[model samples]
Target: MKKTILVTGASSGIGRATAKLFQSKGWNVIATMRTPEKETEFTELANVLVTKLDVLDLDTIDSALAQGIDKFGKIDVVLNNAGYGLMGTFESAKRESIIRQFGVNVQGLFDVTQKTLPHFRQNKEGMFINISSVGGRMTFPLMPLYHSTKWAVEGFSESLRWEMAQIGVKVKVIEPGGVATDFGGRSLDLQHNQEFAEYNEFVNAFMKAMAQSMNPETMTKPEQIAEVIFEAATDNSDKLRYRAGADCEQLLGARDKMSDEEFFAMQKQILGL
Candidate 1:
């Protein structure tokens, strides 16, 4: 039987890239997004099933899972790639924005994972390839909220991996650093306020440094991430964590080697604070 994969937030970037790559590899692709109608490219493909799946909406989440199974008969892996980064200063962020950050990044991811549990439990064999960030293992200025969500994902997926071992289900996390995706552009939510002009110098410096991190020469590509996701999906190894690109390994290496105070001091020095 051919393997099948379900990908959320497949409109563009890592999700879109993964769907295309998996389809090329002959895996059935469930390319889901918030607006299925807006997707014009994937519909023409024979094996691609473009559907609506907003993470915040439980109805759509369950419906998409059912729809994928109805078409493919079985789902081997679920790529929970439907999240955006909530960037900028947390202090200046509106309460609503802060809540929505957790809403999409943390709560939405949790909801999707929970919804997939029943189907995975029934199948007796399945995998959840969650897309986390290297930020989960480290920190960055002006991205406290974003880092918090990723840290939550890292913890959640790690614990889930342990618990799922009892069953046949497998959980793996992909930690990518500064991938050159729309994640740094349209998908990023920034907080700003004229009322808090004092932090502008630090904020601007941080944004500049963050932008440099996403330069094509320094960052990982979405297609490269697709390869890691594929390996996590098919490698069948019991390994629970996979680092994508050299930047992820290096930065996370620093975090792993440094003490708490040392890491903070190193980060402050790098940011020129």
Candidate 2:
């Protein structure tokens, strides 16, 4: 029998691309999004079930899982790709924004993994391909909220791998450096504070440097990330991390090899901050 994969946040970007790629490979795809009604293309595809799954809602998660299993018999992998970044200085972040960040990126991911663990344990073989970023292993200024969530993801995946190992379940993390996705437009939240005008120059410098650095010439595409996800699913390795974008390993390597001050100096020099 062909394998099956369930992908979250499949309305666009990496998740959508992954769903398409897996289906083309003859795998049953459970392509889920918060608003499945907003999607049009996946509905017409055979062996693909476009379902509604809001990560924050456990009920939706359960429903989607049940629906997928009922339709496809069994799911071999679960790709946690539904998340958004909250950007800006921590002090500028609203109470609700801060809560929402952890709620979705951290707690939301935790809930999904927790719900899937029992199923995977029962199967004695499964995989979790988490869509984290290179930012998960590194950090930048004016992005405490965003970085915090990614850092949590990295740590969570690392620790969880040990537990999953006992049951033949595998955990893999995709760390992309700079991807030209809707993340910068729709998946980003900008936190600001008029009271903190003193920090405006810093934020402006950071944004300017970021925009100049993560251009199309250097960034990865959705298809590229999809390819990496496919490899992780079929690589058949006990490996835990898969670096996806051009700068993913390079940027993360600096953090691993250099001291905090040295890494910060290099990053500042590159950004001209």
TM-score of each: 0.96, 0.97
Worst 10 residues of 2 by lDDT: 210-219
Candidate that would win on TM-score: 2
lDDT of 2 by residue, 1-273 (tens): 989999999998889999999999999999999999988899999899999999989999999999988998888999999988889878888898898899888888888888888888889989999988888888888878888888889999999999899999999999887888888889999887867999898888889888877677568988899999999999999888899976887898778999999999998898888
Which sections of candidate 2 miss by over 4 Å?
Answer: none
What local distance difference test score does each model get?
0.89, 0.89
True lDDT of residue 140, candidate 1: 80
